[model samples]
Target: MAENKSTSARAASAASSKTEADIQAQIDQLRGDIANLTKLIGDLGSEKASQARARAEKLRDDATKAGQEAYDRARDEALSMEEDLEDRIRMKPLQSILIAAGVGFLAALFTRR
Candidate 1:
């Protein structure tokens, strides 16, 4: 009877040790998985930030190009108007001077009030 009890005790101890080792291995594996997941999330965030910056730069460049085009069109229209006025004045200098004097007199009259 004593021999049988000793064999059973040894068997129980070995089983307990194996169970503890398995539990420890599983815990280590879970820690490694969590670390890998954290790193993946960080990488994804960086990629998104880079994409956003590129989009913003493209929008800025497009806006600048549009503004320059508008300015050039306005400048051309103003030059055309200036040339037309100069040609009309040269065609009739005396009439242009009389019109200018009338406009100045009206302006002075309004300012006096």
Candidate 2:
């Protein structure tokens, strides 16, 4: 009976020690995983920041291009309107001059005779 109890105690001690070692190994593995995860998160954050900066630069460039295009279109439209007005004035110069002369002559006649 004494020998049997001694053997049983030894077996229990061995099992408990193995369990403790397994728990320790798992803890170590978890620590390593945590470190790797932290590094990956940091890398992702840096990549995200760089991407954001690139996007901002692209947006700024796009806005500048759009503004320039709008300015050019407006300038062209203004020049076209000026040209159209000039052409109309040139086409009717004789009629405009005659009308002005008639108005002036009537005013003079009314004032003098």
- Model 2 per-residue lDDT at 93: 93
Candidate 2: where is the Cα deviation over 4 Å?
Answer: 69-113
Q: For model 1, how does the per-residue alpha-carbon lDDT over 1-113 read when each residue is reduced to its tens digit?
A: 99999999999999999999999999999999999999999999999999999999999999999999999999999999999999999999999999999999999999999
- Candidate 2 residue lDDT tens string, 69-102: 9999999999999999779779999887888899
lDDT computed for candidate 1: 0.99
